[model samples]
Target: MVIGLWLASLLLALLTLLPLWRFEAWWVRGLDFPRLQLAVLAVVIVVLQLLFTDLTQFNQWSMLLISSGCLLFQLWWILPYTPLFSKEVMATAADSTSPCIAILNSNVLGPNRNAQALIDLVKQHQPDILVTLESNSWWQQQLDQLSDSYPHSVKCPLDNLYGMHVYSRLPLHNASLQFLVEEGVPSIHAEAELTDGSRIAVHFLHPAPPSPSENYSSEERDAELLVVASSVKDVTTPVIVAGDLNDVAWSETTRLFRKISGLLDPRIGRGMFNSFHADYPFMRWPLDHIFHSSHFTLQQLQRLPSIGSDHFPMLVRLCYTGRQQPQDGVDPDQDDKQLAQDKMMAQAVAPDQVHRPETQAVP
Candidate 1:
C-alpha cells in the first residue's frame, strides 16, 4: 500500500510538472486543460497519504510536499476565473440603441445529427450574429431557416471537419474566407456594420484541435491564432474574435493570442464557462470563446443547453458605445512572444508544399 501511494504521488507530480516544458505536442499542451481536476485529485491524494501513512521517511515527506505544490500551482492558474479576481471586462449599461450585438458561438459536432435542437436553440436566443464550427453541408442546410433573420452569411462547408459558417443580422462588408494556417482550416474576417453606422472588425475562427485524428502538434492551431492576432494587433477599429477556439480561456497560447491581438476575454472573473464534452459533465472544459476589444462592454455571457454535440453553445452580448479603456488580461512577456513565433515557424509551410492530402478532395 505504501509503495502504491508513493507511485501514485510521483505520477501526479509528473503530470503537474509536464506542462512546464513549453512543448507543442498535444499531450503536453493538453495538460493545461484540467488544472481544476488535477488540483482536486492532488488534494485528495495528499489527504489520503496523511490519513493512512506516517510521514517519517524521506520519500513520504517528498510526496506530501510535491502533492501540496501541485495543488497550489493548479489553484494559481484557476483562481482568477472565479470571483476571487475582479472581472477584466466591466459591465456597462446598455439600451436598445447602445450599438449592442449578441453573438452565439457553437461547435456542432460534424457527425452529430441533432440539427433541429441547435436550430431551436438559435430561434430561442435570436443572437444578432451566429458562428457555427464543425458545420458541414448537412448542418448548413439544417440552419438555412436562419437566412430570413440573418441576411448576411459566409459558408465554408467541408467533410474533413474544419468547416464553418457565419450568419449575421448586422450588415457585413469586405467578408472573405481565408485559410489561415492549414489549407483546409478556414477563418472569416469582415466588418460588421452596427445600427449606428459604426463598423467593427470581426474575426471568426475554429482551429483544428491537436488530437490523434487531427494534427499531432498544436503548432498549426497556435500559428493560425497568432497569425490572426498579429494581423489585428494594431487595428484602430473595434474588434471581435469569436468561435470554438478548441482551447481553454486560461491557456498559454490563448493568453499569447490575447496579448498579441489586444483582445479581452469576458470569461475572466466570470466563470469557467466550460462548454466542451457536453455529453460528459465531469470531463468538460471551456473550448468555445468570444473575445472583443475594449470598445465593447459585456452585457451578457451564457453557456447554452447542449444541442447533442460535444460542445455547448456560448452566447455573449456586448454593447459597443465606443472604445473603452483597455482592460488587462494575461499580458504575454518576451518568452511568450518568442514561444508563439517558434510555434508559427515550426508550422509554417511554403505555398508549394501547402497541399494536404485530405484537403485535395473536393468537398
Candidate 2:
C-alpha cells in the first residue's frame, strides 16, 4: 500500500506541470483552470513524502524525483502572485468633475431571440455608450429604437462571430470600424466628445477566441490585442478600451497587454469581475474587462443583469481629467511599455501570417 501511495503522489505532481506545454488540445486548454486544485495536490504530495520517509526501500531515486517535482509545482503555483507578472496601479485625481461616462458591453448570443430583455437592461442603465457583440442584422434591427436616444452610432452586423455594434450619446468623431486581427473581426476606434468638452479616445473589440471552429491557436487573438494596446500607448487624450477579451484578468497574456498598453485595470486591488459563463458561475473568469489609460479615473464598475445571453454585460463609468504630464508627478516614460506590444502586434499583422483570417466588412 505504501508503494502505491508513493506512485500516486508522483503521478499527481507530474500532472500539474502538463499545462506548461504549449498545445492546442482541449485537455491542455481545460487545465487552464484548477491551478488551485494542483496547489492542493502538491501539498498532499509533500505530506505523503514526509510520511513515507521510513519506507526507504521503495526506490530512493523515485522518491527523490517525486519530491523535486512537488517543489517545482509549488513554485509554479505561486508565480502568478509575484509582482513581476502583474502590477497594480492606483486611481489618480482628476480636475474635471461630473466627467463620468457610463459604458455597457454585452454579447447578445447570435441565435438568441429575446431582444426585449437586452433593451430593458439598456433602458434601466441609460448608459452613455452601449456596445453589443455577436450581433447580426436581426439584432441590429432589434436595437434600432436606440438610434433616437443615441444619435451617434457605428454598426457592423456580420454573420461571423465578430459582428459588433456601438451606440453612443456622445459625439463620435472620426469613428471607424477596423479589423485589426482578422478581416471580419471589427474593432471600433473613435474620439468621443464628452459633455464637459473633454475629448477621449475609445476602442472597443470582440476578437474571436482560439478554438477549432474559430481558429486553431490563440496567436491571432493575442496578436490583435497587442495591436490595439500598442495603438493607444502614447495618446495625449484620455483613452478607454473595453470588451470581451476572451482571457482572464490573471492570465500572463492579459497582464502583458496591460503593461504594454500602459492601461489601468479596475480589477487591480478590486476583485475579479468574472463576466462569462453566467450559467455556470463557478466556472466563470473575468473575460469582460474595461481598461483605461492613466489619464482617467474610475468612477464606477459593475456587472449588469443577464439578458438571455451567455455573457452578462459589464458597465464601467470613467471620469476624464486633463492630459497626464511628467511635471505633475505622473511618469512620462510610461509609453515605453508599448514597444513590446508593438513588436508582437507588428509580427502578428504581417502579410504572410496564416493564423488571422481574411476580414470582410458588413454593409
Best by TM-score: 1
Highest lDDT model number: 1
TM-score of each: 0.92, 0.76
lDDT of 2: 0.70
Q: What is the per-residue lDDT of model 2 for residues 274-334, given as tens digits with 9 covering 90 to 100?
A: 6888898666767888888766666677888888888888898877667652221112243
* Regions of candidate 2 where Cα sits further than 4 Å from its true position: 1-98, 325-363
Predicted candidate 1 versus true structure: per-residue lDDT over 276-329, tens digit per residue: 888887888888888887888888999999888889998898998676666776
Error of 1 at 253 (Å): 1.1
The global C-alpha lDDT for each of the candidates, from Candidate 1 onward, is 0.83, 0.70
RMSD of every prediction = 5.2, 6.4
